[model samples]
Target: MEFFTEYGEASQYQIEEIIGRGSFGVVAAAVDTQTGERVAIKKIHDMFEHASDGTRILWEIKLLRLLRHPNIVEIKHILLPPARREFRDIYVVFELMESDLQKVMQVNENLTAGHHRYFLYQLLHALKYIHAANVFHRDLKPSNILVNSNCKLKICDFGLARASRDDPPLAIFWTDYVATRWYRAPELCGSFFFKYTPAIDIWSIGCIFAEVLTRKPLFPGTNVKHQLDLITDVLGTPSHETLSQIRNEKARRYLTGMKRKHPIPFPSMFCNADPQAVRLLERLLAFDPKDRPTAEERL
Candidate 1:
C-alpha cells in the first residue's frame, strides 16, 4: 500500500494524516505550504485500471467542475502524476471541513432543532443547484455531507451522479445500486428499470432528515425485499397506478402480491416533530416520484 508523504516538488502541501477511507478512495488532511490553509485531498485509487471506473471518476470531476455553490464542496485542485496515461491515482483537493454530518450527529448530544433545520436547508440548497444543472446526485447520505462547527453543510461524493436531460438518450440508464441501502429511494429499491429522476435525491434527503431528528436510520433493511417492506410499513403500499409505473416485471409482481398496509401518519412517525417539518418530510418521501416535492419547492 503506497501513501503520499508530500504533494508537489516545492512541498506546496504537507500530508498531515488520513481523514477517511472507503471503497472509492482515501481522503487525507493536508496543509498548503504556500498559504497555510488546510485542505482535504482525496486520492482515488486505480482510477485508470478499469475503463468503467475511469469513466465514473471522469464524470465526477466534470460535474464538480460545473457545480459552484456554497453548499457544495469546492474543488481546490486536481493533481495528476507524471505519465498521465498510465497514472493510476487521481488526487482531488478540497477545502477541509471540521467533520462530516455522520460524525457530528454521533458525538453531539445537545443538537437542537435549529441544527437539524439548518443542515436540511443547506442540503436542499445544494440539491436545487445540482438538479438545476440537470444532474442527479444518485447518492445522498449522512456520511456524504460535510459540516463545520459553525453548522454549515456541504454536499460531497458525486462519483455516482448522472446527468439528466429533458430527454436523455435511449442508451443512458441509471444504475439500480447507486445510493446506500438506508438512504435509497423507494423507486430505486422497488424496481430495477425505474426511470431515474431527481426525486430520488429528495427521498434520500427525507431519510437523512429523519436520521438527524431521531439519531437513527429511518429504514434500515437487510435486503431489497426487506427494504421495500420497511418503506411500505411507513408510507404504506403504493397504489395500483404507482405499482404500474415499475418497469421491472418481477419487482412489480412482488409488490402487487404483498398485503395492503395503511400509511403511518408522519406526526406519529416523527414524535413531537413540528407539523411543518413532518409535512415536508411526507412530501419528500412520497411513494410516487411525481408526488415528491422538488428541492426548490421544499425550500
Candidate 2:
C-alpha cells in the first residue's frame, strides 16, 4: 500500500501491515529495527489541511507528551519531515496493541464478568489520572480504548480532549468529528449546559461499561432526538429539579414538554449483569452530571 511504501524517513522501523484507517490517519503495525520492539505507526496525511485540524493534532501531541501514565497510550517517537517549514504528513510511533476494545468485543464472546470488572477498573484508573491532570477525554468509546491479549487497557485519541481548568462550552450540534452519538452524554446531545465537567466523561464510561457487558451499543440512536429518546427510555425523564439546572432554555422546554418516563429497572435491562455493577452503572449514568461519581471516587 502507499502507506507502507512512503515511509523512507521511518526506515528504522519495518512496516508489517496496515491495521487501521480513519479520517484522522492510517495506522500500521511495525517493528523497530534497532530496538526490535513492535510498534504502531500512524501517518496523518495533510495534517495542516485545516487550521483547526492542525491545532488539534498539536494538542494531542502535547497532551500525550505531558500526561504519561500506564493506562494512557505512549507516543514513542515522531519522525521528522525532510523540510522543517513544510510537511504534509506526520508519522507517530506508539506501543503496538493486539486490538481495541471494540474489535475484541466483536470477535470474543467469552469475555467473563471478571474481564468486565478489570476493564472498568483500568478505565477508572486512567480517568482518575487524567482528571487529576485537569484534562478530560471528551471522546471516549470502545474504539478509543486499546487492549491486549493480557487484557491491559490504554486510552487513546486525544484529539477531542480538553482541559477542564479553563472549561469551555461544549458544541451543541453533533458532528462526525465530535463524540459519537451512541456514547455521548445527554447534556451534550442538546447543549443542555454552558459549562461541561468531568462528569461528561463519566457518562461515556457508563455507556461503554454497558456495551462491554452486553456486547452491543447501549443506545444506538439514528439521530440526536432518537439518541435522547433511547437514553430516556432506559433512565427515564429528568426530574424538574434537574431540568431547572439546564442552562439552555430550549433544552429545558423540550424535556418539560416530553412525556414523562419512569426508569427501566437495571435488572430487567441487563439480566446478566451483577447487581453491584448495575448500581455502579446507575451512578455513572445519572441524569444530572452533579450526581455522577468522579473517577477518583469510583476508584
Candidate 3:
C-alpha cells in the first residue's frame, strides 16, 4: 500500500505494506534501503487540525526521547517537512514489531503460564523505569503493548502520559478520561478522588494481566457508572475510609446510597488461573490506590 502523502525522507525506505490504521494515522512496514533494516513509519495526517492531537504528538515525541528503555518503543527518526511549505503532517519512524498484545489475545489461545509471567514481568519492569523518572503512562492497555514473535514486549503510545509532580493536585491535573475505561482505576471512574498517583498505572497492569489470563477484558463497562459497578461487583464495596477519600460529594453519596457488595474471590472468578497468580492480582486490584503494590515492589 502507498502512503497517503509523500515525504522526501520516505524515499530511503521501501514501503512493504500498510500494517495498521487508527484515528490518528496509518502505520506502514518499511525497509531502510541503505541498511536493509525494517521499520514502521507512522504518518499522522492533519496533525494540526486538532490542537489536542498536535500537542499529544509533540508530547509523545519529547517523552520518547527522554525515556529510553529496552521495553519502551524507540523513535528512530522524524521525517522533516519541506523547507518552504507549511507543515501539516508528520511521519515518525519506530522499530518494527510483529503485533500488539490486543491482536495476540484475540487470536492466540495457547499462551502458557510461562508466557503470562514473562509478559507481566516485562510490563512491571518497564513501569518501574518510567515511574522512577516521575513519568506515568496514563494509558496502559493491550493495544499499546507491542510484542514480537520472540516473546519480546515494548510499551508504546505516550500521548496521554504525564510527568508526576511533587504537588498531587498538579500531578493529577488531567481530564476524567485519562485512560481507556476498561483499564481505568476506580479513583478515576467518576473523579471519585481528588488526586491520582502511579498506582493508577499499577491498577491498569492488573486489568491487563486479567485479560491475558482470561483472554477477555476484566471490566468491560458500557458507561462510567456501569464501569464502577463492574469493578465493585468483583472487588466489592470500598471501605468507609476509602469511601471517605472520595472528594466528589455526589460520587460519595452515590456509593453510600447503593447496596453493599461483597468481594468475589479471585480464584472463584478466575477458576482456571493459578492460585499464586490470582493472589497477586487481588493486591493489584485493591479498591484503595495506596493498597496496590508499586511496579518496583512487584518486580
lDDT tens digits, residue span 4-101, model 3:
35567767889999999999999999998989899999999989899999989999999999999999999998988765365888989999999999
Candidate 3 at 14: error in angstroms? 1.2
Number of clashes found in candidate 1: 0
TM-score of every prediction relative to native: 0.94, 0.94, 0.97
For 136-166, candidate 1 gives per-residue lDDT tens digits of 9988999999999999899998888988765
Error of model 1, residue 234, in angstroms: 0.7
Top candidate when judged by TM-score against the true structure: 3
CA deviation > 4 Å runs, candidate 3: 1-6, 167-169
Candidate 2's displacement at residue 277, Å, is 0.8
Count steric clashes of candidate 2. 0
Error of 2 at 59 (Å): 1.3
Clashing residue pairs for model 1: none
List, residue by residue over 1-299, the lDDT tens digit for candidate 2: 46744546677988899999998889999999999999999888898898887877888898999999999999999988767566788888989999999999999999988999999999999999999987878899999999999999999999888766552344333233458999998998878876677898999999999999899999999998899889899989999898988887877888889899999999888889888898899999998999999998998
* Candidate 2 ranges beyond 4 A from true positions: 1-8, 166-177
- Alpha carbon lDDT of each predicted model: 0.85, 0.88, 0.91
Q: What lDDT score goes with residue 283 in model 2?
A: 96
1 or 3, which is superior by TM-score? 3
